[model samples]
Target: MDNYKFILSGGGTGGHIYPAIAIANELKKRYPNAEFLFVGAKDRMEMEKVPEAGYKIEGLWITGLQRKLTLKNLMFPFKLISSLLRARKIVSQFKPNAVIGTGGFASGPLLKIASGRKVPCLLQEQNSYAGVTNKLLKDAVAKICVAYDGMEKFFPAHKIVKTGNPVREDLIALTGNKKEALSFFELQENKQTLVVLGGSLGARRINKLIEKKIGFFKEAGLQIIWQCGKLYFEEYKKYNSDTVKVMAFINKMNYAYASADVIISRAGAGSVSELSIVGKPVVFIPSPNVAEDHQTKNAMALVNNNAAILVKEKDLDADFDTVFSGLIASKEKQEEISKNIKNMALPNATKDIVDQIEILLKK
Candidate 1:
């Protein structure tokens, strides 16, 4: 049909937000005139991220309940009721052909109402361990697109499809541009480069580990492009010298991936998926604060196959230096890790996820 309508909900972190946008972009490519609406938590990153991706977004008065007994937790019931009501209103007004959820606080209410209305619904779960929101909506959604195997435990076996996680197309395309990449980063071709990512807000422990290794890295003739993240830029910005490039953010990840010989990063699903395509020897330090410790679970999928390394935050003090040093010094180890991780990449994940959506629409 020339005019198709779809409602998608996912937000909070870039992990949840980027996948939803990627799916939308794919759908738009197939049905150029399709109308897409994104529902996200008001003031969450998706509110801005979705629109920036050129899709219309509606925000719900929703927030995830905290683990601690706080005022926000007390208001959880009221917020849920309000969000459900708002979701119902949006579903009725939009009359979408189908609804999609990528797993976040806002998606819970949106998918629940859409499913209750007998609208076709789909979910894309990026993690090895399912999120609570996705688990709750398992029975309601018509399809579950997953990145890892053995998700049948959390989702209906018949409904689950292993489509992998959608990643930025641009980053994936830059895999072969080594010379161009090094030029963009202003680095010489002879020196091995180490790329560090601590997310947009920075990882406290990763930052400290990098700081401690500053002299070691320079002495070893390794160039550094450290994304210190916005939160800690003030404290770490002074490390920006000829050998060390400390950035608050790196908007051009394609260049970063192209230039890197080795990478150190948090084990978030989005980071893992992107790194798979980048195919460099990566050291993953999974954050302990995430729900169900999913970051480590995400990293283990790579480590189990010898695709990458996992250095738990708790063990970083004792293990980071040793693990990082070993990976850097051994050319064979770097090449082997790079080759394995690249094999795990699903470069067409964005397209594959939209393929599922199209199938659901036809059904």
Candidate 2:
């Protein structure tokens, strides 16, 4: 426990990277003197986001292979080899007590090298469906932390721990701030509110749906806070008004959740976890473009429990009006979803994940 060193790797998307950061922050609090190094894909968002979070991060020459045939697919082997070699060098020089992965391309090489070097390795798999890199490295890791149940289907039962995904701190503290949140968003308490989230980069389908039906929502007396994402803000910003607020991002996500009576969001693991804690009725629009279409799987876990509703991107045209109008009109359905989703929330997920990692350090 004396001046312990730890290496944590996760990247490519905020879903993976934020969990790694949450874990790192928790570990730093517990082990005040511990050293940390983060490894992320070279051109991925994590390289910028990690340093902004105040941690030293090294980049690996890694990228996921394209599903369709392309020139990038041809460079896959070279990238993999270079990444593995770089990963080995980093692990060997740092000589960390523990290595943790939150599931992205860089984690594949880093954790593989760490496990081979006999360093204790831990994994946090956020999705209901496992990523390819997580599945490939499953057997070698010391402990596997997960957000959902039935993950034994993907990893060894003995090593799997049901610790929910780590969410942003503000969103976790949202339950009590409803009045303040309503004021923050400048919405009326008497009106129903629907919050749309597609993450910062945006979801093309969700944005399109909002554009098509903004008037319908306003006419129905629903106050809307739409985070159309950074990529789509310019195109959709013209829709913003007193009743409808549109932005590239919502810096105060806690307020957004508090102001929301019903939320319409993409079913990424992090968003699902946040929605659960907020304990509000949610409609999940899972992105089909994600690897293995795991977003749908993430949404289904809640749907099966009657905790949330899922509207596939392809089915939005036929299903959105019925599904949305029904939810907005029924107070009973909203309460039922709220109660069920609260039951599924793992509020202490960050603490629980770190508890497992600490145990790994002892072994």
Candidate 3:
């Protein structure tokens, strides 16, 4: 078991990729000599991120199918065939004791082939709504590790384990202090700080909403730390001032979480898991563009518990001002939301996930 070899596959976004990486890190901790090979789609963020996290990764020629007819859609069959062949080759050669998939386009072919070859497989589904890839591979995987309740609607009840999403280690415990965090972001200690996160690529609607609300935020006696994402940084950086900090990305999220009085964020599963652990009052703006509108479902899971607030995209113009103002004005509301959200945090999620993987490997 000490020399166990494992293949981890999941990618396309930070939501899927980070959970896979977190699981691998935990497995590495348990078995120091274990070998891990990550498989992801070519040119996806995981190709860069997995290696940066100190793991060897291979990329398959694959991409998700488009909704409308297009050249890429026509190429889907060929890409899937090529990816399956490559995945089979990897599995046969690596002979992994267990294959873990976190759910993405890349994981479909890899997990399909590994499970077909009789290798034990486990899946981690991060969203409240299951991804297409996870659902397709549900029967093939021995166990499905899920973060939210009611996943049996998408996955088999017997195959499901209610282990929350694995968050990045840095976010699990913010070691930085408020004073240093304030200094790091160059914000005034007297002003209440609001942090805006639009995921890695930024959200167009959210960015526009923030742009229009700058004066509103200033009037509310709040300072801002806005992560506009790399694609939109240049367009929004002009708004940066002493009270409003703007950046393409945040390298030190621990400090950002530490300095925040309130947070406005996209409802990605990874963000939800991290925010729960951070235990801050948050307002979620779920992106409507994703498959199955999973973001909305992810937000509703917390909003139902009164652990967070949700302002839909269509209602942002009308609801955001009133909702934000009401929340900010009430210290009692903030503390109540913060405490409730913290109650939902699964601090030992990574460890719990790895324990399931161990069961599969032993079988």
Candidate 4:
């Protein structure tokens, strides 16, 4: 009679979608017979990603409220009402023992309705700075799972659990094999390697800076592993040479993290969490395009602690050359950054989050 049902909701970007899937996967591992359903925004990335993760998903006609004046903002009320009704229906039909939301556009409505119906809901907040949606639903959520410290500024202090983020299991597995990783990338055992990632979609500023500074990397004699993302792949692929490996998507992220002597990346919450676990010297370039500038706050949490370096997007073009070159040339600085950031790793976050769910479900 194992009929424990769980509904997991999150979407809009890989940042939100992946964490929800990681939690769902953890639940599956612990409760093999549990039925799981995902709720995400219609026409969003989650519609495709959730199915790919081997779960059933229902989409709501939900969108984020516009920040600027537009016709879309005029339709906001109708979409909100429709989505709330749809979410309530899904919650009633699923009859979930417990529901989980990783913050996103769909999560606000889905968790709100589930909480209104007396279903226990868990909110996973990934950033150091909480988003408006998560902040609005904080009181309605049964418990809050967070990656950063001092989130009491946003959530009820008693309900907060510092469970770090649940990253891809593969990235955690990278901790063991450094030598195997260098060989896998066909990198020389002794040379310093630098890994540059602009996320899966790529950051325009980071890509442009790297594209224009190829000779600097060559002059420094540093080996490069660049993940330029899908958007700028074609334009940047020509920069690939014997010393530099360029890719649109890196299927084997564990190898990339393990092989790197240093990493330059955008400071998305997920990337920050994974980088912390990988324990590499990292330079963060937080994207200016994100809502509330949460990415900068996410990186600053670490930078303030001397765990990593930050290069503002606008400053990357002018300042990155000297800063990057100096860091790569200093082994002491690299080791110090690596050791400091590794202190932030939460390797057991998946287990902790699942444990929280189990505790709430049993109650």
CA lDDT scores, all candidates in order: 0.91, 0.92, 0.94, 0.90
What's model 4's TM-score?
0.97
RMSD for each model, in Å, please? Answer: 1.2, 1.2, 1.2, 1.3
Off by over 4 Å in 1: none
Kindly report which residue stretches of model 3 are placed more than 4 angstroms away from their true locations once superposed: none
What tens-digit string does per-residue lDDT give for candidate 1 at 1-363?
858999999999899999999888888889999899999999899998888889999999999889899999999999999999999999999999989999999999999999999999999999999999999999998999999988988988999989889988787677558788787878889999999999989999999989998998888889999999999999999998877899999998888887889999999999999899888999998899999999999999999999999998788777777888888889999999999999999888888888888888888
Count the clashes in each prediction. 0, 0, 0, 0
Task: In model 2, state the lDDT of residue 281.
Answer: 98
For model 4, the superposed segments whose C-alpha errors exceed 4 Å read none
Residue-by-residue lDDT tens digits, candidate 3, 60-107: 999998989999999999999999999989998999999999988999
User: What TM-score does each of the candidates earn?
Assistant: 0.97, 0.97, 0.97, 0.97
- Ordered by lDDT, highest first, the candidates read 3, 2, 1, 4
What is the lDDT for 88 in model 3? 89
Residue 189 of candidate 2: its Cα lDDT?
Answer: 88
Task: Answer with 1 or 3, whichever has the higher lDDT.
Answer: 3
Kindly report which residue pairs in candidate 3 clash with one another.
none
Worst 10 residues of 2 by lDDT: 168-177
Task: Assess the local accuracy of residue 249 in candidate 2 as a C-alpha lDDT between 0 and 100.
Answer: 94
